[model samples]
Target: MRMVWKTMRLRHVGMAFFWACSMLTFRSSILLTGEANTPELESIVVIVSFVANMTTLLALAAWAENDPERIDRLPLWPMAAVVVVGLVLVHFAGRVGGGALLPFLLGGAVLTGVGYGAFWGSWADCYGRMHPARTSFYVPVAFLLTAALFLAVSLLAENLSVPAIVLMVPLPVISLVCLVHCRAEVPDGRAVPEGGSKRSLLAVGSLIGLIVASLVLSCLFGFMWELTVFTVGSVNEAHLAPLVANLMVAVALVGLVLYARTRVNLDIAYRIVVPVIVVLFAVLPFFWETNPVALNIIMSASYGVFDVVIWSLVAATSYDFAVSGFVVGGIVRSLSVLLRLIGIGIGFLVTLVPGKPSALIVGVSLGALYVLVMLGLFNWLRHKRKAGAEKLEEGAQTDAFAQLDTSAPDEISETPGEEDAAPAAGAKSTDNTMPAASAKPTASAERADLDDEQALYTTIAEDYGLTRREAEVLPFLARGRSAKVIAEALFVSESTIRTHTRRILEKTDLHSKQQLIDLIENYE
Candidate 1:
C-alpha cells in the first residue's frame, strides 16, 4: 500500500520540482540580461530562442496528434533534456573561453527554449490527463505552488552558502525521473478520456478565442513579471525579485483556494474584478512614481486572478471537447510556450522604454484594454454556446414526448412489433432506430442528445447486442473514458481496450464515442 502511494506521488513531486525550477529560470531572465551588457547578445538570444521554442512546441503538437504516446517515450522530452544539458555546458564554456558571448548566448537560448517546450508539453500532458475534471483549478494551483517554492528557494539561497547549481538541479533531475516512471506504468501512452457529446461549434470557437487571448495576456504578464515590476523604481532588484515573486504566487494561491470553496462564476468575476484591474493598469504610471510596492501588489493580484481564470477556461474547453489527455496537453503546452516567448520579448522591449511615465501608462493601458476586448469575445462565444445547449436540451425533452406519442415508423419501439403489430404489412425495425448510418445526423437525432452519459452507454450497448467485454468497455466509453483509463479499470493492456472499443464501434454502427453517447439520447 505504501509503495503504491509513493508511486502515485512521485510524478506529482517531480512535476512540482520541475515547475518550481521553471519559475526560477523565468525570474533569471532579469539576472541574465543584467549581467550581459551587450545589446547584440540580448537580441540574438531572444529572437533565436523564440523561434526554436515555437518550432519545437508546434512539432510536439503535430507528433502528439499522430501518436498519442506517453510523455517519457515520445523522444521529444529526452532530446529536449539533452539540449538543456548542452545549454548548461555552453554557459560554462563561455565563462572559461572569455570572448564575444553572442554565439554562446544564442546557443544557450535555443537549447533552453527547446527544453522548455518539451518540459511544459509533458507536464501539461500528464496533469491535464490525470486530472481532466479538475484541471481548471489544478493547473493554476500547480503553478501557484511551484512559484511559491521557487521564491522560497531564491530567498534562502540568497543568504545561504549553497552552490548555485543546487537551485537548477531539480528541474532536470526530478522531471526525468517522473517521465521514466510514467512511461513504465502507462506504456500505451493514451490518456483515459472523459466521455461526452461533440462540442458545439460555438464552444470550439470560444476555446480558439481563449488560446489567442491567453497568448496576448501571457506576453504582457511576461513583460511585467520579468522586468517591469522590478524596475518600477530605484529599488534593490535582487531583494525585490524574490519578494515580488512570493507575493504574486502567494496571493494567487490564497485567492484560488478561496474561489475553490465557492461557485466561482466566470462571467461575474470578469465583469467585476477585471474592470478594477483595468483601472489599476490605467494608473500604473502614477503608482510607479509614488509607491512601487503598491503597484507591485496590484499587479500581483491581477496575475493571481489571471492564473485562475485562464486555467479555468482551458479546463472548461477541454471538458467540452471530451479530449484525450495527450491531445489537450499538447495543445495547452504548445500555446504556453509560444505565449511565454511573446511575453519575454514584450517584457524585454518594455525595459527599453525611456524612463517616462506617459509611455509606461500608454503601454500598460493598451495591454489591459486589449485583454478586455479579447475576454469579451471569449465570453460572448461561451454564453452563446451555453444558451444553445440549454435550448437543445429543452427541444430534446419536447421531441422525446412527441416521438413517444406519434409512433412514426422511424421512431421504432424497444420491441417494435410487441404492441402495434395488428395486421400491418411492414418490414421489421431494429430495437434502436437511428437512421441508417451516415455522416450527417438527422434533426430528430440531434434532439435526442443526452446529458446522463452512463445511462446512454448501457442503453446503446444492450440494444445493439455487444459482447460482455465490449459491454464492460461501453459504460466507460459513454463516459468518454480514455483508452488508458479503460485499460487500467479492466486490468488489461491499452491495446486490448482499443481493440474492444473498435469492435464495439463496429457492432453498434457508431462512428465515434461521441456518436455513441448521442445515439441513446434519441430514445429516452
Candidate 2:
C-alpha cells in the first residue's frame, strides 16, 4: 500500500510537471500575440482555436474508441503533428497574407483540433483503465500539478520569447516519454457494447446530455480564458496579472484536493459550484471597468475551482459508461466532444456580435445554461435511481431461482438425520435471501441508500464486469502513471498489472486507456 501510494504520488508530480510545461508554452504564446486590437482578428483567432480544439477532440474520441491500444504504443506522433501543423499554418498565413492561406489556416485548425481531441480523450481513457479506483484523486492531482507548473513557467517565460517556445517544446517530448513507459500496461476495453436497443439508446441519451453539459461548461471556461487575457491587457499593472492568475490557480488546486479527500458527489458539487460560477460571472461585468484587478482575482479563483471540479466529474462519468467497450464508448465520447466543439463555435459567434460586453454576455449565458442542465441531470439521476432499484429487485428474484435449481440436488441428497441440519441451513439461507431480495428495492427507494460516493465506480464495474483488482487500479491509470509506478504501489509485478489490465479490457470490451479514462470522467 505504501509503495502504491508512493508510486501514485510520483505520477501525480510528473503530471503536474507536464501540465505546467504545457500551460507555460500555451499562455506565453497567447500573451505574445496580445489581445487583438481588431475585433475581426480576435474573432478569427478564437474561431481558429475553437476549430483546432474541436477537431482534435473528435479524432481523440474515435481513436480511443477504435484503436486505444496504440495510445501508449506510439510516440507523441499526434502531439508533434498538431504543433508542426499549427506552426506551419501560422507561418504561411503570415507570409501569404491572402485568401490562399485561409485554407491552410483552416487545415491547421483541423489538425490541432484532431490532435488535441485525441489527446484529451486518450488521456482520459488511459487513466481510467489503469487506475479505476482513484479517478477522483489522481485525475485532479495530475491536472492541478500541470496547471501549477504551467503558471510558474508562464511567469518566467513572459519576458523571453524564443526561450519560452523552446521550454514549451519539452512538454510533447515528456508526454512521449510517458507514453513509452505506458506500453506494457496493455489496453483495458471498458467501452459499452455496440448495438441498437432501448438500453443503448438510453446510454446515447445520457451521453448527449453529458456532452451538452460539457459544452456549456467549456464555453464558460473558454470565455474565462479570454477574459483573463483581456484583463491582463486592460490593467496597467502588468506584474499583478500573473500573480492574480496564480492565486486563482492555487485556490482551485486546494479546492480540488479538499474535494478529492472528501470524495464529494459530483451532483452535489455541481449543485453547489455551478450556482457560484453563475453568480460570479453575472456580477463580473460590474467590476470589469471599476475594479478589474480584484474582480479578476476573484473570478480566476471561482472559475479555476469550478473547472477543476468539472473536469473531475467528466473523468468519473466517462469511466462509468465506458464499460460497454470502445465502440459504444467511442460514440458516446465522440458525441460529447462534438457538442463541446459546437459550444466553442457558438462562443466564437457570440464574440462576433457588436458589443464590448460580449464576453460578459457569453459568460452569463453559459452559466445559465449550466444551471439548467445541472438541474435536469440531477432530476434525471433521481429517476434512474428509482428505476435501477426496481431492476435490482427483479434481478435478485431471478438470481434466487437460479441458485435454488442448482442447489436442489445437493439438498435432497441429505440423509434423514440431516433433515434437522437441512432446516437450519435452509433457515440461514432464507435469512440471507431476504436481505439480498430487499437490498435493491431499499437502494431504489432512497437516494441516500445508494453508495453515491461509489456511483461512478459501481457504474463502470457493472458496465464492464470489472473484477475487484481492475476496479481498484483504474484511478491510478487515469493519473497517467507508468506501469512501474503502478506495480511498485500495488505490490505486484508490472506483468501482473498488465495481465489484469488485459482482462479488464476484455471484460469491458474497450480498446484503449483514453477511452477508459474518458468513460470514468464522464460517467453519469
Candidate 3:
C-alpha cells in the first residue's frame, strides 16, 4: 500500500488523460470531416494545411512562455479552461455538415490550436515547476493514455457523426476533473526559488539549446505517424496500433519507475534509448505497409520511452540552476510543440508529392536524427565535465573538513599579536594550556566565542536578503566563532568572513557581531 501510494499520483494520471482527451477532441473533428469524402483521408491533408496550425502554434508558444506575467505566479486553471473551450468548439464544429466545412475549418481549427497552446504552455510550466522528479513515470503514463485515446478516436469515429460528438464529451469532462484535482500539487523539485533565480536561461548555455533540439527531433517521429495514417487511410490498422502501443508504453513505464525508485543512474538509458528510437522511426516505416501491427508496436514502444525522457528533460530544464523554471521550461516545451506542429505540416506537404514518396520521409527522419545524435554527444560530453568538476569540489571540501575537528579551538597563532596581550579582567580563554598570562579578549570588543546555530540561520538569512552561501555562514556566526575559525572551517579567508559579516550587518542594520547574535536569538 505504501509503495502504491508513493508511486501513484492522481494529478499526473489525470493530466495525462486530460491532455489525451484534449488532443482527441481536436482530432475527432478531422475524422468527422474526412468521413464525408476522401474515404482514404486525402482531404484530411487539406484540413491540416488549410488550418496551418504551425505558424500560430509557434507564435503562441513563444508568446506564452515569454509572457512576463506568468513568471511570478502560474495561472494553471484559466489556461486549461481556455484549452477546453477551444477543443470543445472544434468538436462542435466538426459536427457541422459539408457546406459549413470552410467556415468551421477556417475558424474552429485555429481555435483548437489556440486552445492547445494555452493548455500546453501552462501545463508545461506546471510540469517544470512541480513534477521534475516524477517526470519519468507520469510522462509515459500520459503518453500511453494518449495512445489509447488516439486508438479510440480511430475506431469509434468510423461512424463519425453523433457518436464522435458523444465521444468528445469525456474529453472536456476529464479535463475538468484534471483541473479540479490540480488544485493541490505535490511539491516540485529543482525549481527556481521564489522571486526567481540570479541568472537567465541564456546564462545556462548549451543545455537549454540541447534540450530544445532533441525535443524538435522527437517531433519528426510524431510527424511520421500522422503522415502514414493520413496518406494510407489505414484507420482500422491504426485503431489496433494503440493496443500494442499501450502495452509497450506500460512495459517502458515499469522500467522507468523501477529506475526512479531505485535511484539508478540514467546515463546508459540516455546513451541508448533516444538514438535507438530515432533509427527505428526512420527505418521501420518503409515496412509499415507490410506489417502494420508490428510497426505500431515499435512506434508505441519508441513513443513510450521518448515521452518519458522528453518530459523529464523539460522538468529538469524548468528547474535549471540559476534560471526561472517557468521561463525556461515553458519556452522549451512550447518550442517543442511548435516544432512538432511544424514537422507535421512538413509531413503534410511531403504527402502532396506524386505517389507520396518514401524518400522524403526517410530523408527528413535521418536529418533530424543526425542533428540529435550530434547534439546528444555534445550534451553528454558537457555533463561529464560538469560531474567531474563537482566531484573535484566535493573532494576539496572533504579534505578541508578533515583538517579541522568540530570542537577545535581557533589557535592564538591565527590572530597575530594576540600572544602579547594579557588576560582580560573577567573573561577566560578556552585553552588553559596557553600561558596563564595570555590575554582573553572581552566579549563585545573583540572576542567571538564561536557558536554556529543552524536552526535560527534560515530565519535570519531570509529576513535580510542573504544568498544561499551567506545563509550557510549565518549559522556559524551564531555559534560565536571568530573570523579566523569560521574562515578556516569554511575553507575561506578571514577577510571573506569579515566581508560577509559586514554585509549582514548592513542588511540587518546592526552595529556589531554581538548585536547580530542577539537579533538571531530572537528569531531562533
Query: Each candidate: what lDDT?
Result: 0.54, 0.51, 0.54
- For residue 249, what is the lDDT in candidate 3? 68
Write down the TM-score of every candidate: 0.65, 0.62, 0.62
For model 2, how does the per-residue alpha-carbon lDDT over 1-524 read when each residue is reduced to its tens digit? 12223335343324444445433323334322322223334335445654555555554444544444444454556665575455455435535655755665556545544544445544555544543434455555666666555655555655554334455555655664564444234344344234323333454565454445544555555454454445454322322465456555655555655545444455455556655666666666665656645544554455455445554555455455543222234454455444444544554555456667645564666556666667678868978999999999989977876676556545544445443444444334433333333333433446553456366666566445454457767767767677789989977679977877667666656787777677667777
Q: Compared to the true structure, candidate 1 yields what TM-score?
A: 0.65
Pull out the clashing pairs in model 3. 422-439, 423-439, 449-480, 450-479, 450-480, 450-481, 451-478, 451-479, 451-480, 452-479
Across 1-524, the per-residue lDDT of candidate 3 in tens digits comes to 12332545556656565556544543333434443333233234324532443444345444533343443354444544554454444444446656765565445455555555545544555555432334445555667676666666656666543455556546645754564554344221223343443343452343454454556454774565556566456534443555556656655665666555532233346546666766876787687556644544565466556555655655545543434444554455455555656666686677678763567767877887888777778777988999999999988866654454232235544566544442443325545335332332222223233333443564455345343445556878877989899888876678877877777788688888899888887764
RMSD score of candidate 2 (Å): 10.3
Q: For residues 1-524, what per-residue lDDT tens digits would candidate 1 score against the true structure?
A: 11212223445535556656544544343224333423334444445655675677667666555344434456645644654563564345345445645556666677766776676556555543332223433445556666666666665655674543456655676676776665453333243322211332333355564455555555555555445433543222423544565557556554754555432445345356655666666667565655544544555456555555554554444443433344454455466556766665665666777776446655766776777787777778988999999999989977775665456434433445633452232425433332222212444455565445545554454345343456667778767889999989987789989987877678667788888777645656
RMSD of candidate 1 to the truth, in angstroms, is 9.8
Best by TM-score: 1
Q: Which stretches of candidate 2 lie over 4 Å from their true place?
A: 1-4, 9-43, 63-76, 84-110, 160-162, 186-211, 223-267, 291-303, 314-374, 377-418, 423-498, 501-524
